[model samples]
Target: MTDTERLRRWRLVLGGDDDGTGATLTGDDARMDAALYKLYGSRPGGRGGRRGAGLGDSAPSVARWLGDVRTYFPTPVVRVMQRDAIERLDLTRLLLEPEMLDAVEPDVHLVGTLLSLHRLLPDRARESARAVVARVVADLERRLAQRTRSALGGALDRTARTPRPRRPAEIDWGATIRANLRHYLPEHNTVIPERLVAYGRRQQAIKRDVILAVDQSGSMAASLVYASVFGAVLASLRSLRTSLVVFDTSVVDLTPDLHDPVELLFGARLGGGTDINRAVAYCASLVDRPDDTILVLVSDLYEGGVRDELLQRIARLTASGVTVIALLALSDEGTPAYDTENAAALAALGVPAFACTPDRFPDLMAAAIEHRDLTPFTNHNT
Candidate 1:
């Protein structure tokens, strides 16, 4: 394909807008360039030239297009499409082959590529094809961790200087009065202590516990991705303790791999019959203080387990002081066809069944940390 043909195809893909003079792609050209930059910026030669097919006359550009094809095309044709695109560019940069490797490693390399393809993905593909996001985040986590300690060390220092509140103490006033007797002036007046203040602030150590119970049934892929990311974040916090449990028929504690989110996600069984009740019971047992622990159940509420037992377990967890959050999902799409009847039943038990969005999760964690009531998201019963 000539550069002009490539430019024409790209224009068609981006929904070309007609400029009166027709000298340039304009409007949509700018938009497509921005999108292309986002997909290719990590590579060299990603910057410059918002117009012209020659803008993409580079090895990295062809590599990125190959990456895009691998992400957008079905499993069968991805490799063929990538090879053809690489041949068309005929560039010898390392990115060409790396891009092919990036495409073929379905579970590892497709995440960032898919994230770039988000705008183009259809509904069915959006849910089904996003399983690779966990792998991407795992890769990202490794890269971030390398420089994180040095970058965050100063921030940690600022936090360490903050004053903490003191707790009420049981005390004897006699010793307090004796210590203050010198100020009382023994010659003229005797002073009684109005109230006793502790010599120093005694701050109680607060330990936060987060229990993430993820439902790993086939369609709940997005929820699994979000759960893995959040579990890793909670694990990194100094004050919080996080346990990540993924389940379908049985619960497996992936907490030990929290430091490596990808490992935790890979350790999970992604598709199977869901026994939500069994998972909840297992999660309840793993937590020490029900009140101090935040139990986040991410599922569609589809169950192979007994419904009555599941509701009872949720109730028990809440009544025991565990801040139970029954999330039908943790995705950009709030909730999809969930079990409404089961959701309502759990809500009645004070379980707060609601759909949680990924962006609102940090606030949810804050509420959990403070042991405060979480303002539930849209309630889609069922």
Candidate 2:
């Protein structure tokens, strides 16, 4: 590797500590080092090391450090550092403070932490926490709304096209001509269209039902945020009926709050035993049109309820023409922890189970809505 690349690698490995790596950072790199040191450097009695004294017991110091990290690092790196501060420095309690919430960068993980501490947040801090969550939800909506709407809308248009038509008004001439070019007869010096493709009549609109059955067992926090945001987006469309169901031993339908993802997330009760079977049963009940509904179960598949019943429910959904899919996670974080056996069983039932990143989720939904084979995503888990 080049000298610069080597220095970068060593800087990451040593974190903020001044090791004997003979590499000195400058400019923004130096500023990043200082921010890292503030969070990860040693203090008083301890020797100089990567494990630092943390932000100490002072809320102001912690708040300053939060601002510094956001200023120095990119959003993604800042989010990771924020999570690390919460885990390593025991800053979860401080998050209940208004100043701390005000200073921190809004993200899914931070929202998850706030949701976990919901019952404990004082009245004064509750408003601030909700603001933070609202900001994050708005940012996510801006980033994902258009892409999701376009993909699902396109899928609906494609699915509405019929291959056979009895009337000329229903015929999709462009598609029909494209699909029948192979039947051209050179002897007759003309193109003979053997098959007719048409667009479905635009009458009593066929609204698709989308049920987001998400697992909210503490570990699935990121997935919950993504699912809520997507649910809100789907619910906005007049052509789709969207329902949000979050489960952790119990199921809570947040469909009414789908207009605001922040509210939907706040309604969720995180951290509890998972009951996949019960959740699936509830989602199944919501499906009025089995052929048009897409049931996405976002879970790690660590079944705390009846495992056999869970598999049976999934099998029944798939057999009944409901596009049943299992998402182990819905974050950018690399491969997630999920039950291999459960994933395998879902696969056996013709249901694709895999971890899907938020960016890929829109396309995944498009594929599901269009009834396309999900081998591209499912094969990754296998």
Report the Cα RMSD per candidate: 12.4, 3.4
Give the number of the best model, judged by TM-score: 2
Q: Pick the candidate with the highest lDDT.
A: 2
lDDT of 2 by residue, 222-318 (tens): 8999999999998887777889999989888999999978878888888989999999999998988999999999999999999998888888888
lDDT of each: 0.61, 0.85
In model 1, pairs of residues that clash are: 290-321, 290-322, 338-382, 339-382, 340-381, 340-382
> What is the per-residue lDDT of model 1 for residues 75-142, given as tens digits with 9 covering 90 to 100?
55654444333344443232323333333434322332343344455555444334455546765456
TM-score of 1: 0.56
Worst 10 residues of 2 by lDDT: 43-52
